[model samples]
Target: MNTPAALTLEAPAEHPFAPFVRILGKGKRGARNLTREEAREAMGMLLEDKVEDTQLGAFLMLLRHKEESAEEMAGFTEAVRERLTAPAIQVDIDWPTYAGKKRHLPWYLLAAKCLAQNGVRIFMHGGGAHTAGRLYSEQLLDALAIPLCRNWQSVNEALDTGNLAFMPLQDWAPHLQRMIDLRNTLGLRSPIHSLARILNPLGARCGLQSIFHPGYQSVHREASSLLGDNSIVIKGDGGEVEINPDTLSHLYGTTAGVGWDEEWPALSARRHVKPASLQPEHLLALWRGEVEDSYPQLALLSTMALALRGLGTPREQAFEQAQRFWDNRDTSI
Candidate 1:
């Protein structure tokens, strides 16, 4: 965001990081680009609630105006990295950004749990509460009998046993967690919001994802394109990485220099499902730990599946990833 010269401060070392702050204050507003370490400091202030609401809003809007630079985004990822107990699952897989799942179906958690059950360990991040329209994800995990854990010890234990684990940002980054008030009062997303989606707290090497807004699709790709030649990305329900198979058409995915692929060949592409009332049903299923039922995602689910699966297989295979889960007797996948 807009780094104002007048707002400079000398942290106490006393203040944790005062000298660096003094130097940063000297940084030219327009000429300077934030470093990873500097970004972490910003995160500390944002997360700790040290930044005032107005300032926080300004930071976010300005940052967005300037466009969240690749370095800045990567730097911000540090806080997310520091905010979790490591995933304990022995099997390796990239855990997608399961941010803000309490808004609807705990899609990221479900996908994580399903993958975990199938021998994959997932690293999901989120513990934010602000908008009245949204609820905390921990509540959903609790409803499903899943422990909303706080550290590596508990997380690893859960992963080893139930193939699931939770690492709420509040526990790891209270500074960031406390920002809920900032967001609520400001009525806008802060720089932290952008940082939240790109989190990789578990040190996960890769993940299959469903992202929100096609505009952001490119950022996700650029952020993690180095992880693999076969990286997966989806247009999520709300910027998340899960897909609903009942709807969606061909997916759009790219690997930057790695090459982009479309023309999927996996599952049978079909018309969108149009039942009158399935949101409640899917919500109920989520709490009951029944993940097989497909939720009415307003086409987000279908779109994501097409995008992620279409990367490797044909459209049918990608679409089937969601369909197979819905039609199967076991929804654990």
Candidate 2:
């Protein structure tokens, strides 16, 4: 009569992605890697909102704590691409910009416009301002009168009319955009940032990307290879697809689904300098020839050269052609 009921605790039900979290979060000796299929399934569950909040947070943190494998990154990206829809227009290049510029104006925007002017159909997609103080491509596109496309239909229409269109990440995939927005709460970037860059929803023949950290270079290279897409991943200034005219750049890429790499020498030997401020007018003026700034010119030409290279132009010839296109650009605005 004096004996109390035996104390007992039951384990919680297993979430679908719980195993994935455990595989990454297990103490070093017990942890293991998830196969590509496993990663694809886990990511599918995440995108479908099948995983619980606790499991989702644990999964994302586990991925952040451990460097993501190429298989993992590629699998997650494959899931995203499968879930998204884009018009079947013939896109020459896939340009994904997630990293906003803090120290420099996004010269890459003008570079994409220049390529579009030369008959290169480009589809640009990106998320905006999570970290503050950085200049996002979306914000700057408005000043240039480039409308943000709402869907594949609008994207197709814009490309048909102008050969270039910018789509926001929120419009393309809201779930992933929600994850990206968590950068503020998580206090660090999760693997979603990397996966978003390689989606290439239109199945474009070529893709261009940039990373802020040097270590992630190989991650992007191998992931792009696994996705079987032609891509160029560079350590661009402020982590954009644009380069700094004063610094040599390492270009990691793939061709016809094969990995290749090269170094883009600096266009100028002078010390690196930052503009006093980012005025959208400066970008417009530069493109219209109202201003003559050597650094910005080199940035645009070199950035476009990389895109042209992805399109199969020889290195030297690509740079030369980019310069020619810039000089011949329509300036009636």
Residues 1-333 of candidate 1 have per-residue lDDT tens digits of 978778668864444443334333443553354676777677666655665555655566556555565556666666556644454345244443435543355455545444444444555567455555444455566645556676767777876777666677666666656554476666665556555555655544344555565555566556554323234555655555655444352333444326354433322356444444324346556435555433443243354344334334455564566445433424332
How many residue pairs collide in each prediction? 24, 0
Consecutive 10-residue window with the lowest summed lDDT within model 2: 139-148
Kindly list the per-residue Cα lDDT of model 2 for residues 16-54, writing each as its tens digit. 677888888889899877788888999899889998877
Global lDDT of each candidate: 0.52, 0.86
* Off by more than 4 A, model 1: 1-57, 79-110, 226-231, 244-333
lDDT at 56, model 1: 57
The CA lDDT at 79 in model 1 is 52
